[model samples]
Target: MTAMIKAHEIQGVIALENSFNRVGLDHVVLVKVATAGVVTRLMGGSREEVINALSNAWIDGQSLRTYRHAPNTGSRKSWAAGDATSRGVRLALIALKGEMGYPSALTARTWGFYDVLFRGNEFKFQRPYGSYVMENILFKISFPAEFHAQTAVECALQLHPRVKDRLEQIEKIEITTQESAIRIIDKKGPLYNPADRDHCIQYMTAIGLIFGELTAAHYEDSVAADPRIDVLRDKMTCIENPQYSRDYLDPSKRSISNAIQIFFKDGTSTERVEVEYPIGHRRRRKEGIPLLVKKFETNLARRFPAKQQKAVLDVFLDNRKLVGIPVNEFVDMFVI
Candidate 1:
């Protein structure tokens, strides 16, 4: 979903619409990891990839900086498939060895990836880390959605209980998202479709308010028309939480939390509520971790009400889980 939504966002960027490039470097981050994968994989298992990996990474990187916040549009954003292994293919074609066509194709755009994509200005990398290849920790955890708004959705889930009753009375919804998020995810205008709908923090939060939750189903065109959703989105106003912004960037303390509060027409308000890190974040490892066993258990339980969830769980728990397990045996577990 991140890829699909990101592609849409890329379309917006190409169209020269609102650029997330200025404040939030979300675009370059994804593009680099995507195009540079093969080169990075080849450089070393433990050691970082060679400097030449920069070539592709640079193109992907500078593109983010080139048009951020400048309204734009294009079809690139709609590509459902991710990168096409540009690094390996490029290497295979050139077979060049000594100096690179350039170092850091992504993060550096000038005499680099930029000359290829953005025209000229040097692309700026947000931070230095091996994490760029895999993507930031926060980006990895999001099954599908922007990293900045993860906590925003998390906050909405928690606030649903309190505000569901007073949803109609909500004169306004005030949100505190990372300042970067305010600059990036905030949007207005016709939502062309679900891909567009999911990225709109206002729309995502409103779904959490009216439905008291969001699931894949909530984004469908049929469901998006719910009267309360548009009402809440239009009534909403969001501001950046400076500290939240700081915490969000701390690599060791990464978070995607959002704080939400609802105001009533009569001038009353509910408790201000917040979610710091989403359940999916790395910090929640000890508590929110979902073991393979639990996934197997829950899945089996759903498929066979009369069958045993414990039996399914035990198989996953076995220490030698996959070793020596025949392909047929592995496939059998999934069948009812």
Candidate 2:
């Protein structure tokens, strides 16, 4: 535990993100699981948590949603972190109860988390649990954008002021992102929806640069159709993260840092800027948690009442109270 960065910590994140990227898992789901798992451990969990969580959790069985489609991503992200915490909790509980895990979990499914998500691989231990995950979770600080695209968004934000007067002067917008950007966000042609548009590195970077602001609405069809977006995506390029990948997977490090550069028709290009972790990461916890809480508050208020929201927030703020609260109660609060 001293040497290893808990899968949920920033260090763990660094390792998992790079390794999973090889197989196609985004840092988001892994981050969720890592946070939830490590947190669960903090709450004194065991293996039963993982199994029971796995049992109740559904695998969509749809090829479009399966790992084989991308060999890296899937829908499990929605609940996987919760699943992970539950798994951790279950494992802890199982150990407490003196029950045994199905030995097959380590080898059974055509491949476990390894074979299924990892390309017939095994977990390579670079270290053990520590404050690493919290220390390195990338912060979505500048833009509430995805981790991989945040730097690109930041670059666009900078260009927004300069390009505002030259929207027409820009013959083409050129930008570069890490290789993960190309695989996960780079796109061409008409982006039909916000989901599609936001994922397009070109669309995301261009809009941020042009508008100086990016929100969930920025990715919508109306915004995506703004002609300028496609013009920019047309100029975008993304490449693999050799060092980022190296540092990303090094058990002692975890980051979603990305570099972004822009060019104008006149041939002058802005300096490339790189950012490693999202503001929401643990390293920035001292500064970012309050902001994350704000985000959580904003999001919670959107779907829940003030009183209910208060209760939920209060519980989350209190570690002892939160861990003791029934899972059903937590589920009930989230359910409409």
Candidate 3:
């Protein structure tokens, strides 16, 4: 767990200033690099072996960000991180088997990663990594929407009871959000599938406003077939609030803020509902952790019998016991 957290921090801190998207590369490249470096160390590889594994990861072809954007968005965006991590392990194993690595994989003038993938710019870091990323990780507790749209969905849910029965009377729904949400999730056209819908702020807000809740199932075609969702989506517009955008990038704040207001044709409007921090934000950890534990237990019940659930929960619920258990032993407990 500690090794994994370090890996996450390495990837996240590098990503803070490195705009891979601007160069058409996916952020999962960091996942592969970080994972290969740390997993090699965890496997008891020597310093040279770790360096070799990291070089292999850098030279491994990266996935294009195209699959995560409009016109090509699909399930590949969902599985890309897993694929990167798997490749990371493969590279680490190859290094352990004595494979030689290019010492200048990242800086080899003509054919290196910096020139070929990053537009000739070297990687940048905001800070030397430690546990910052793990300590400040955001969780998607109540909604399955994109992280940038999480607060947007919360705002919509807050206004749901007032607007659910007045769908026809609503003239427009204005969504005020951070620039990141606009850049990544503000969609104006037809969404082809669940992947597209989940990434669209308008579609996610529509679901929350109409149903008073947003869930993974809500993104399915069966529920999406409901014409009312599109009706609300068609009446929606998203605008960026500069302050929200600034706060989103502020390391001290790291907020994903959003506000929603519904205007009725008759001139009355729902009070603007704003959510600065999501339920799963670190700022709300006191209120969020219990819900997170409940969610975990509920998920466990879906896959395990009652006795098995209790057995697993016994160790998991006890922090000392959970952390003290050997990795292999802990993994074996879930094998059944």
Candidate with top lDDT is 3
Cα TM-score per model: 0.66, 0.66, 0.97
**lDDT per residue (tens digit) for residues 1-336 in model 2:** 331355545435346434555554543444434443344455555556544333222121211223222333333544655554454454444444544344454345774454566566656654455564555556565565656677667667766777777765565554544555666666666655555555566777788877888887886667766877666667666666677766654555555566766666787766676667556665567878788778888888999888999989998899898778877797887876
Q: Residue 296 in candidate 2 has what lDDT?
A: 82
**Predictions ranked by TM-score, top down?**
3, 2, 1
lDDT of 3 by residue, 55-145 (tens): 9999988999887778777989899999999999999999999998889999989899998888888987778878999999998888888
Between candidates 1 and 3, name the one with more favorable TM-score: 3
Query: Considering summed lDDT, which 10 consecutive residues are worst modelled in model 3?
Result: 65-74
Each model's lDDT comes to: 0.58, 0.59, 0.91
Off by over 4 Å in 1: 1-20, 23-81, 84-111, 114-136, 139-144, 291-336
lDDT of 3 at 151: 91
Ordered by lDDT, highest first, the candidates read: 3, 2, 1
